[model samples]
Target chain A: MTALPPPSAKKLGLVIDLDTCVGCHACVVSCKEWNSQSPLGAPLADLDAYGAAPEGTFLNRVHSFEVTREAGPPVVVHFPKSCLHCEDAPCVTVCPTGASYKRAEDGIVLVNEDICIGCGLCAWACPYGAREMDGAERVMKKCTLCVDRIYNETLPEPDRVPACVKSCPAGARHFGDLGDEDSAVSRLVAEREGFALMPDQGTKPVNRYLPPRPRDALPEFDVLAPYLEPVTEGAGGFLGWLDRTLGKI
Target chain B: MHPAPSLILFTVLSGLGFGLMVWLGFGALVPLGWVGFVFWALAYGLAGGGLLAATFHLGHPERAWRALSQWRTSWLSREGVLSIVTFAVMAPHAAGSVFLDRPLPVLGALGGGLALLTVFSTAMIYAQLRSVPRWHHWTTPAVFMLAALAGGGLLAGQVAAAGPLFALLAVALALHWHMGDRRFAAGPDTAESATGLGRIGKVRLLAPPHTGRNYLLREMVHVVGRKHAARLRLIALAAGAVVPAVLLVALPAGHLLGALAVLLHLAGMLAARWLFFAEAEHVVGLYYGRR
Candidate 1:
């Protein structure tokens, strides 16, 4: 079962706008809250819940970086990373137990906890660090794209996306069939030039991140005008200049 | 990239066991009568015990049998299947040699070949991982194969064969170290590429994903000091290859020399295996600016 199926026509994926993400960690929290109650890798236990240096498995994480250009104002780029649901997901192929697999219907990658030995090879195979080994549950955990929620008919249509996508306050996350050229997510990708995390790795990730648009230059300000005026005065000798500069200031 | 001690021991001990089995297959060091049992016992003990130790690393050892079901794609599954086949084939070969006091040449050769294949499969488990550039190279499996040959030769009491095998091991180890260090220094991937922020300028870590050490960082972000790693590499080379080769070539064939050589070589192999894991640079480390 680890042998990948032929590429599916409906490539369901997420497109994240890096420009609008505020590094609020809300998506991470929402993902945790929803998945902790799901069938697989449930009750994602924290080794030290209330103690110092709490550690646990998470399906998604936000990393903040300070990008400094030599001439422009520094900008903080917040990157939200998760399972890309790759066309050739290494995590799926490297699983020894056939527990990690990709759906042939919609290209959603998932882990079957029933057969997982939790040897941690899938996690090591992942270049994006999207897979997490849930030690307490004894299985590998990953972003399922909320298969349970998305397909559940009981939930209202507006509330039927992945928890992270539905809860994002900044509306940075978008989900739809990317295989459709005219889909909103596909159009966004086309317009914004969304990119994969490491294209050279050949994962061909379904999820994309739109880069932050280039910032405009700051407005001009005469910060030194008041201090410079007295030093250039007409009466200037060393002492006169010093007195004027001191008195004027 | 965390150098789990069990895995280091697993590769070293298993390689030594399977290597000795190869020698026994070729009648290179065939002991007669009752003594043959001790030899086969030691070989199977090291290989089987090492494999058992590896299972301890799994989160659910009870479900470890499920690992064999996915051999079509996974190197880990291939390793599992090959290990089982190697043991099944080698068992009868060991029985004929010990119980019948005779060598089954054809059967022994098949078992020996499978043993070698199992070792290659084990190496491929790491070699196939593109996520860790340090381990994803031809040199990884080559190094594993060479170490098995060299260590097996010494353990099988083939002093003459040990000399040349150890020499090849020395050259291979040096090349592996040189390439691994250079790759770490200037590989293609970087933090900028990881985040797709290279167009902006240099990217620096402003804030980590969390204040605490998460599972990803704990398992994949291990860092070793450059100076210490260099020193360890030298020690591994000397103890594993140079000293063993020199002793085997210059000294008389005696129990003391053989025992001393095997012990030192094992220590060296352990160090090298530890470095193999500890020094690996996982691509995920780029996100945390660990690269």
Candidate 2:
């Protein structure tokens, strides 16, 4: 059951834009709010919520990095990390119980909480650290891509996307079938040159992160004073020179 | 990795137990009377006790039986299945030797082969984890097998074979630990590669998502200081392999000396297993800028 299904024609995934993300934790919160109450990982455990070290299971997290470019200004890139839902997900394969599985229909990796023994092997197998152990429930939890919300007929079509994608204030997150080249997300990846987190790992992650755009150089101009110029010629006094110049003109 | 005490104990104890079973199956150094019964009990106790301890580490120990269902793809499941099979095969072999007063050569050979396979499967559990580069090596399995043979030989009263076995274990441990240390020192994956930010420049973590420890950090972001790690490595090598080899060579195979060698080797292997888990670097660490 852990063996991956044959390549699906429709690989549903997310595309995150690094250029547009402002590191505002809107998506992270929205994802928690929705999934915590949903069936995938209901009531995501929060240990010592009001204490010195409040720990909780989170499906999505935002990390900020300062990249010091060679001979260029250091760029602070806010990276949002989540489940890549790899095509060859090791987390799925390593599960001793058949609880962790990938959906052949869409390639979304999920854990069957009813069957999971909570051995913590799946978390160890995941390179992205996407899966977290829910302390109270004692089961592995991760991003479900808001499967409940995305598939619900009661909600409007616009609200059918993942909670993270909908709540992103910077419009950094995009969701669609990545397998189809003509899909919106796939086209965006093509145009933006999106890339996987660790291609060397060979996870074949479905999601892609579009790197930040190249920083532009400053233009040749004095920003402080564009109109002012020093007087070059005034042989006589200021008034005499002005009158002479007026007469000559 | 967190290097949980339960897991360290599990690998070390089970390795020693299964290793003894392998030697017994080959009819090596096995005594003719009450001593053989005692040795069988010791092997089973170590293997069974180690397995029991592993279940305690699980969040749902009551559901541990469910783990045996996915043997085809999962190394953990395969280990579970093979362990049970080894026990079944060895039990009959033990009964024949103890109750019937005859050694079942065929059964012993089968059980011994299965016992070694279980250890191999156990090693694969770590080695197959591509997430942890330190564990993802051939040396991991080699060290595991050597440790089993060395420690198990001492337990089985095969002091003559113990010398060479201990030497092999020392070499394997040294090679594995040295390589693992070098791998950690030379950062393979970086924050830049993790986030695809290398094209831009050198990426460093300015701030983590949270100030407090999260599940990921608690479970995967284990960092041991360089000085402490070096010191522990020396301890593991000296206690686990060197001391046992010296004792086995110096003293004849008496009850007192054999007991001392077995205890010392077990202690050493425990240290080695601890280091094995403590030093593993998970790729997720890159996101936290700790790789």
Candidate 3:
């Protein structure tokens, strides 16, 4: 059962725009907040709360890096990463138990905690570090793509999306069927030139990331230089007279 | 990767156990009656005990039986299935030797082949992981097989065979280390490639995702000190192979000397196995900028 299902046409995935992401960690917070209570999987572990080392599990995480470019001083890129739901998901095949599987219907990778032996081999097999082991429950937890919410009939149509996507304040995370070339997410990916992370890894990740847009360099002369420059040759009016008197003394 | 003591004991002990089984099945030295019982018992105790140790590291030890169902894709699963099959095939053969003092060559040979296959499958579990460049190589299996063979030879009292095997194992271990040490840099994956920021320029971690550590960091981002690793490698080679080889070749073969050699070899193997896990650099660490 760990063997991956035949390729599915519906590649339900996310497209993140790096240009718009501010690295606020709202998606991370939202993901943890929702998945913890969603009843879809085991609750994320939060060990040693309020102690010296507080540890917890989060499916989605936002990492900010300083990319040094030849033209600019340096670019700050906020990278929000999660499970890509890879077409050739190594995590799926490497699983000793049948718990790890990719959906033939949607191409979303999921871990069934009930059967998961939590050997941690799947986590090791994953190149992206998307899975986390819950300390208390001792089960592997990963981004479920909010399967509970996405299919819920009680919620409004607009609200039926991944928790991270719905809660992203910057509107950077877009979720849709990426396999359809005409889908909104796919169009955005095409227009923005979105790319998969570590393409050479051969995971063929369904989710894509839009590279940071080009930024203008700062002016060569400081804008505050004019204000700091002297208004007059010496001190203005009274200060000039006082200076002359002080010099005479 | 984080080298848990349970896993170390599992790999080292089980490998030694299975290695001894290989020689026993090949009709290396089958003692008569009760003596044969003790040898077979030792092999089972080490292998079975080591297997039990593996479950200690799992999150759900009770569900480990489920691991046997996925041999189609998983090497870990294959190892589980193959190990059970090896035991079943060899059990009767071992029983015959212990009770009747007659070794069944055909059944024992089949069981021996299965045992070696199980070890290979175990090696494949790590070697198949492309995420760890050092482990994802042909040398991984070679080193594993050589180590298992050498260790097994020592336990089986194949004194003449142990010396040559230890030498070969030493060379293989050194080669694995020498090649594996440079593999990370040689691989296409890097901090830049992982981030997909290489197109723009060089990438560096200005700040991590969180101030606190996560499971990934705890499990996969283990770093061993350079000097300490070097010292341990020398110790592993000396104690595991060199010393054992020298003992078996130079000194007259006696029970005490053989026991000392085996003990020293086990110690050396323990250190080498420790390094095998501790030194492996997972590609995932590039995201945290730790590897």
Candidate 4:
């Protein structure tokens, strides 16, 4: 007889405040550092480390976007993207080897690398592009929500949070058991108008982002342009000629 | 929807195996001589290789037998069952053709039906994956049918002994090719309405989440260059369908021309099969910043 999954525990989740994020990319680096040494092996891969085509680690990435409002200063939104640990989790059901699965306890989606045949189907099933294949291991890898740190008894109580949450300089990242009505994440969801990325697909992602506050007025682009350093120089003129010759302004 | 090489090989090879079986069975029913025996042998060889290729795609080959149980909900299961049946039928028919004085036409027809069913089932596997808007259509089955007809025509032309069979294969190939072209032209309905956004506005990707390549980008958002795809399509049409038809008409005069046509047709079919996977756009791709 098929065994039933254990009754799910309060879903642990995150609520990111986009308004406060500084786009420092500290979370990206910290996530890589934490997951790189985990039992599942490195979730991130570096290519051409010191060569011409230098590339960094994977796991999570911070994307910086400048959103222009009709009126006000341009808001720089730092979007940190990672596995949302969705409830529906198509990546789990689509796995031909049953290697990718969602934990019944906290709704954390994970991959059992040992059982993975590396067919790469689970990666296709995910709309979020959260999964990445580890070239060295020949298996799929992703964010594990710092499962080792969060559960380890030796770690200090405050440091048990996920690497990204722990390292957020602006206190933009929040982590808690979302299933509890009184949990910090649940309270934030009730008070703030948080939105899920691409919610139509209905993956029921646990992570939520607080939308940036509306701008009342537009920024003066012409005035700001002069103050900002010139990114590229003109083709001809004394300054341009000097820049061309020197390869710098 | 990204047609892996294993799947492409499986579908095309199986289609040829099944199509040849159908033609050979029909010939036997008409009381044709050695022509039927030649087709039966070819069918056995192709079907065997196709089945073996399919096994390589499985993650757990030991548990492959479990796949046969889920036919009620899985086209893949039905394909597995039908492929096995096709092989079981082909073995006896091949034995009779080689050793026995008389070939059983009725038994051959049964085996041929089973093989054809397997091909149709394989086509349905892609057609049923609702996540891929490109594959989830009637055109998918049309492509499978065309592949079989074109492959069968090429095989019939090579044998030379089956004159009427060659003519039928050519006609079927023409019909399938026409249908496939129409389907390929009618691309997926990936409008904003399909994505469930009621607002009327042009949505574009302002920023993607990650900098490095991810599985979704690599698998779902595959973009083949338009000019390259067009060139390949032309090659596939000429080599897979047109050349085989021309060879069928000229087979009586020159045997080498017929042989050359089969080789060209195989290459063309392989190209077409590659495009079939490469060109398909999954609905999940829309979520990953694809316009």
Q: For model 3 chain B, where is the 10-residue window of minimal lDDT?
A: B218-227
Candidate 1's DockQ is: 0.76
lDDT per residue (tens digit) for residues B98-209 in model 1: 8887677777888888888888989999999888888888889888988988899888888998899999999988888788777754666788888888888899989988
Candidate 3: residue A80 lDDT (0-100): 93
Q: Which portions of model 4 show Cα errors greater than 4 Å?
A: A1-10, A41-44, A54-57, A65-76, A179-182, A216-249, B1-10, B18-41, B44-132, B149-218, B242-261, B282-291
Question: lDDT by residue for model 4 over B196-275, one digit each (tens)?
Answer: 22122333334555555554556677775534877887787777766666666654546577677677777877877887
Interface RMSD of each: 1.0, 1.0, 0.7, 5.9
Candidate 4 residue-wise lDDT at A137: 59
Task: Report how far off residue B279 is in candidate 4 (Å).
Answer: 2.6
Query: DockQ values for all predictions?
Result: 0.76, 0.73, 0.80, 0.11
In candidate 2, stretches whose alpha carbon ends up further than 4 angstroms from where it belongs are A221-249, B184-188, B224-226
Q: Which stretches of candidate 3 lie over 4 Å from their true place?
A: A218-249, B224-227
Q: Stretches of candidate 1 above 4 Å error?
A: A219-249, B224-227
What TM-score does model 4 achieve against the real structure?
Answer: 0.70
Q: What TM-score against the true fold does each predicted structure earn?
A: 0.94, 0.95, 0.95, 0.70
lDDT scores in order = 0.88, 0.88, 0.92, 0.66
Kindly state the fnat score of candidate 1: 0.88
TM-score of chain A of 2: 0.89
Fnat, model by model in order, equals 0.88, 0.84, 0.87, 0.11
Candidate 3 lDDT over B58-114, as tens digits, reads 999999999999999999999999999999999989999999877898999999999
Candidate 3: residue A81 lDDT (0-100): 92
Task: Compose the digit string of candidate 2's lDDT tens values, residues B1-291.
Answer: 888899998999999999999999878855555877888998999998889989977888888999889998999999999999999998878887876778888889999999999999999999999888889889999999999988889888889888888988999989998787676546546676788999988888999987888878877888755447778888888889988899889877698988888888888888889889888888898888884
